[model samples]
Target: MTSALPDVARHEASDIALALDWVGMRGIAIPLVLGGPEAAPAAATAELAVDLPDPHAKGIHMSRLYRLLGAFAQHGKLSPGSLQRLLREMMESHTDCGSRAARIGLEFHLLQQRPALRTPGLAGWKSYPVSVQAMHRDGITQVELAVRIQYSSTCPCSAALSRQAVRNAFAEHFGDAPGITRGDALDWISGHASLATPHSQRSEAEIRIRLSPAADTLPLLAMIDCAEMALATPVQTAVKRADEQAFAQLNGANLMYVEDAARRLRQALEQHFGACSVAVSHHESLHPHDAVASCATPGWKRMG
Candidate 1:
């Protein structure tokens, strides 16, 4: 005859009598289908945990937590309501350990197809890193969403200095010539030896916001649109000569510093989200280090 399997976690008791702030799992791989305007499948890394208030209890049921997460993969589309429900269920499942709260985090890359700047039918896929975190405690649930965006930054100081250099070159070439025609000026300016281009670098923006408790869905695509529109120089994917020229024109027109980029993003995001924080980094081409700036609305405590 066979006996029942051994149960160590439920039967044993802990020697130590201290509680942990967070306890469970991290980097749990999961397949997720995010529900929004751009609903798509994402391979996500999940972190799940519950409090262990009962010092006497040996340990929490880790398998039960993993199983609960697996259930979500089977029949859930990630959203505020579903996240809240999952956290509540986690707390209920850990009642044996006297748990009062639970938290879940997911990280993934969201893919978007971007059209060429000037080409009508050409497009390519771009990926943005995204994360969503949620917690349930004391009859309240809070959710925070975050996304990372990449753009281009042309230094205003660099542009001004480059323009000065170009003017100096133009003066030397013309040398007070009489009756210089537009064609002659155009020929000189279009040549490679005429103008010095400003320094531009790839930059990144990390935006995190606290979703209103009453929000039903995640407005990720809309938020991304607002930020890209405000900044006006998102990095391109499919590029022909004409599209590249148009992109260069856009960069020349929207020259900005790190501070300018931060302010633009803040003003635009604040119009939509009440509690939002923005951090930007410009990987300077001229310098060894990156330029960075950050800002947040009032009463905005950053979520982990």
Candidate 2:
């Protein structure tokens, strides 16, 4: 008979005797099916990992995990039902290897068709950054979904200051003529009031929410709607003069600071989703650095 192959993985001892919390793979190429069978799945990358609780076990079945993931990605639809099954299978595959936990992260872009403001035509596609993570550990199964929303943010303080400047300019222009004609005053203010405008910049809201036990599917579009509705300044698609005016009016009506943006998103998520974390960042045109704010609700469980 031929010489037996040396199974070092099962027979060899480690130089150090210690247990690791997690070990496996990250940034693996995987296609994600973010919807039901009716919707086509999208390509995505994943970080699949498991715990090494047994210090003596040479290694877990890495190939088994990969094959299982391959099957899941190929046939299974990516929703609450499919993700829970995938995580359980992963944990079961490593049961004999002394792994008590397993985790996977899928990152991908979800294309959304946005409607033009005050127009019958539809806007082009807008891709929102979306990530879903599932972890089965110590008998606790948790699933989380994260989405990034982009919009415009106008500075509340800057808006007030600009209004004050306009008032001063109007006072100076009419100081000599208290009895200035209504037409003359209206024309003067029309040209001068807009002279000092507040600075606004692009902003983003990143929200992560854990699914409730009752949830059967990931409410991706609903989550986006909640965030955009609360902020009331989502970036538009197709541009028209009327749409531009509407956008300007929105910014003016919803002047806020970075902290305000964070709280608005957090409050909306808290009221609707219940368990969530939100972070908002304003890329300031007035300053070189960006402004940021964040909050987490009580139901949120921090994941690694």
Candidate 3:
């Protein structure tokens, strides 16, 4: 009875006789779990495709690819090894149709609980956007991982201008009053320190790195932590009055332009990963446009 079913995909020849680069599914929703101490199931969107190298073939078997993805969703732990295995399986499943290459992409958010800057026992969940890509071509497999980290960037120029304004205010108030005491200065600052305020905006850094073939597990949390530490001004999730004050202090201490941010991230990530690409964007609060900077190590090939 099974043999009576139509197998047109395997039996028929293509009318167009044109080879295609890729043919398969996209926007497939699947459950994925990463390998780590805190790993748990997370929802991910996946794209699975294989190259249609044979111009004479009618079409590749779509059901085989879907079933394999379904099986991975059920029991697979996402890692460089696992993704490579999945891509190999994808290519094998299409050998009858002459597929020579395959690739899989996964996009998801990794949530982490972060503590407040100065508040004890206060924390909140922060979500970071992450993506993983694995490609098998010409008997070689390459895997890449990328993550986006949100931070706060205070404009260095704005900070300097604001400081000058405060200094001018202080001189004006004290130029005529020669007998001013420390208490008087403190009181004046308390009353008018914010006469001019530095402009700060939320910024984001995207780091993409090629995974080493010997890598066994995804390094999502480690990379996130390293990037955040390098930036030194990650946006706070849970903030009390004290935490807000601490955040303000951090912004004032680490005033940076977009170039500064890109350099900081690129230098740190390069040290950690040997080579990496970093792109940073500051959503400008002072203007109608954003300020952006990017840098990559030599010979870095970004995944598409």
Candidate 4:
């Protein structure tokens, strides 16, 4: 039985956007399976984006992207290989629409274990939000990964001031008692000064790279570890008295301003990802501002 409705014509494009470089959706949410550093797969909420390179085109077929995501949701693992496949799928979808380039951004929360300082067996999961981005053009692909870690930083200037305050306090309290032990002087100093101001800065480490199609899928855990080590003090989940003391000692040893944090991350990324570009941002507490630093290799020059 034929219906009376007329057939709609298929939309076609000859010349799409000659003026615009990129156009697409952002903040699309989807479920994802992330693998690595776990006995089983971890479920994560992914914020995904795909670049559609034209305005003259009728519209992006958004359903295709969702279908690709669904295929991955069923059995896909989040590894370098899986990510490459996902990018290829996205590019293929866009190619059907005549796009010469494709880009994708995905954000997810990753979990890692935190070992107790003194207790060897006590450990728990800690969450770190991460992002991965990929771009394809003319058979070339580039990838970037980013992670956010929380850490404590003591202001060196503040630490020095606090030290002087303590010395003065000992002099005033003990009345020039030369017999006072160094430990006793430190105790008196801490009592007189703001011994520890919480310098909780949400820090970020981002690395972008141009990769060979055969390049190994990055070890996400390795990247996370490098960033944490660069920052020096990551917040812990299962902490005891010993852990707290260790954390305090770390803070004291690694006194950093926002600039120092960014530089350290940049150096660490350079050491770890030699062919990649790196950027670090430290959300500062002392001011209503953020401190950011970036370094890039020749391979990742386009990132700037």
Candidate 5:
């Protein structure tokens, strides 16, 4: 025997006349597909949300949203079409509430195999912070991808000071020899390079891209490459003594401040994605707080 229960969501009316902008679940423990159609997808933790524009309805059909998300989770891929379908179903399911839009925020650590700087036989795993956010409204859908990549940031000021100290030391030691031999200079540099090495700290770049709806794939790996390649000193996974030396050399050549790092990432994103925003933070070792900078898709608000 089944007991009769009244469905309040359908039968009851809202006493309060205020309409809400967004009403739905968040941080739901559901898995999502990462990567694209061609690559093997990885699982992700997702937070889902939907908007309600009506003031008369008491609530919405939450289970339908969950079920739609579950169906997408079954696939090993996420594409523009799939995302649009989810958004459409969400609004249709809660048509009584007159829901107009939906949003999905995903957080996950993506893994990539990285080879040692010097050894071909040695390789290890590196994880990067990845997030994808999407919003659908007024027949317009916008998808944004954010990736965090860690690297080494060396101070140019420190490098200049180190060079001056080295020059002073050389003058004090061999000033009388009108000109020092290459061998002597090499000896001094080899011994002193570590003595006054420039300060470098672990840094990360958080990049976000607004994808075109016409785009099919997620382009996760390509987005990663843009940040890593611009920085040129990505944090190593498996490092040998030789690898350490190579990393030191890289830092020496690419010394940058937080602002410089932001500009570099911006240029890289502009060259690749055409329209995007970036907020890069260089966790400053010299200071107590992190150094941050933000860049956006030039004239995004004016654009349709």
Candidate 6:
């Protein structure tokens, strides 16, 4: 025997996020694929996120998102098309529930390679943290990409002070060498300058950019190279004695302040992404606080 029950029943619904703008899960770890240095694909761990609108909807079907992600993991290629498709699926999941908008965030560690300084072989596995965020509303989608690169920055002030100290020592010790040859003078200067103290700073550049829909490809590794060049010194993975010496010389040659680091990144972004907005932050070792700067697309307000 079957009991008579209505298919639909009236129930009270509560607005949980009346005062809040967004609420969701974060740092959810999952396996993902990213474009390799040579356009091949590599596996990485991805942190995923989704925004929930109505708190009283009981809870989001988290399993559905996971299954959708599995589909990408199984067969999707790591490219602009795949990324956009993932975003589209996430938005559709939310839109089916009568929500107006949805947001998804993914973070992964990408691998790259570097040629050995003294050897002919290539070394692998320089990991960089990358993030991608997608927001959808009313048939429009916006995607943002972020990458963090590790590099070295020598202190300009400290280098200048070291030079001054060396110059003073030379004037005091070698005042009698008036007829010294240029090479001999250089040797004398190097002997005295070797005693000066050099300050080395460990720094990181964090860059965020809005992607062009037409140029859907994500140039994360290229962007990383731009940041490394801007800072003038990037930490190396595989190093020989020569490489170490060269790296030391690089630090000595290109000393910079945190402001200089930010400006360098800004210039690089402007050169690479002409119409894209860029936000750069330099984490400095010499200071207690991080230095940050931002440059926007010329007509961001108009676009908004």
Candidate 3 at residue 47, lDDT?
Answer: 90
Q: Which scores higher on lDDT, 2 or 6? A: 2
Q: Model 1, residue 35: what's the lDDT?
A: 84
Model 3: how far residue 82 lies from native, Å? 0.7
Q: For model 6, how does the per-residue alpha-carbon lDDT over 14-48 read when each residue is reduced to its tens digit?
A: 44543223434556656655544435554454433
RMSD after Cα superposition, model 1: 1.7
lDDT of 3 by residue, 1-304 (tens): 9699989888999999999999988999999987885488888999989999899999888889999999988988888988888898999998888899998899999988999998899999999999888899999998989999999999999989999999998998788867888899899999999999999999999998889655778888889888999889999998999999999999998999999999998888888877888999999999999999999998988764
Candidate 5 lDDT over 144-216, as tens digits, reads 7788889999989988998888878878878788667899899987787555656778988888878875566
Lowest lDDT block of 10, candidate 6? 6-15
| lDDT of every predicted structure (CA atoms) | 0.90, 0.85, 0.90, 0.66, 0.79, 0.65
For each candidate in turn, give its C-alpha RMSD to the true structure in angstroms: 1.7, 2.3, 1.4, 4.2, 2.4, 4.5
**Sort order, TM-score high to low:** 3, 1, 2, 5, 6, 4
User: How well is each residue in 1-304 modelled by candidate 2, as lDDT tens digits?
Assistant: 3248776656776677678887777777887666632265777888887888888777766777899889988887788767778878888888877788888888988888888777678576788998888888878788889999999999999999999999899888778766789899889987887989999998998999988533567789889999999999999988788888989999999999999998899899989988789988999999999999988986566777
Where is model 6 more than 4 Å wrong at Cα?
1-12, 15-20, 36-56, 122-124, 181-187, 214-216, 275-304
- The clash number for model 4 is 1
Worst 10 residues of 2 by lDDT: 32-41
- Scored against the true structure, residue 36 in model 4 reaches a CA lDDT of 49
Superposition TM-score, candidate 1 onto the true structure? 0.95
Candidate 6 lDDT score at position 209: 71
- Model 1 misses residue 274 by how many Å? 1.8
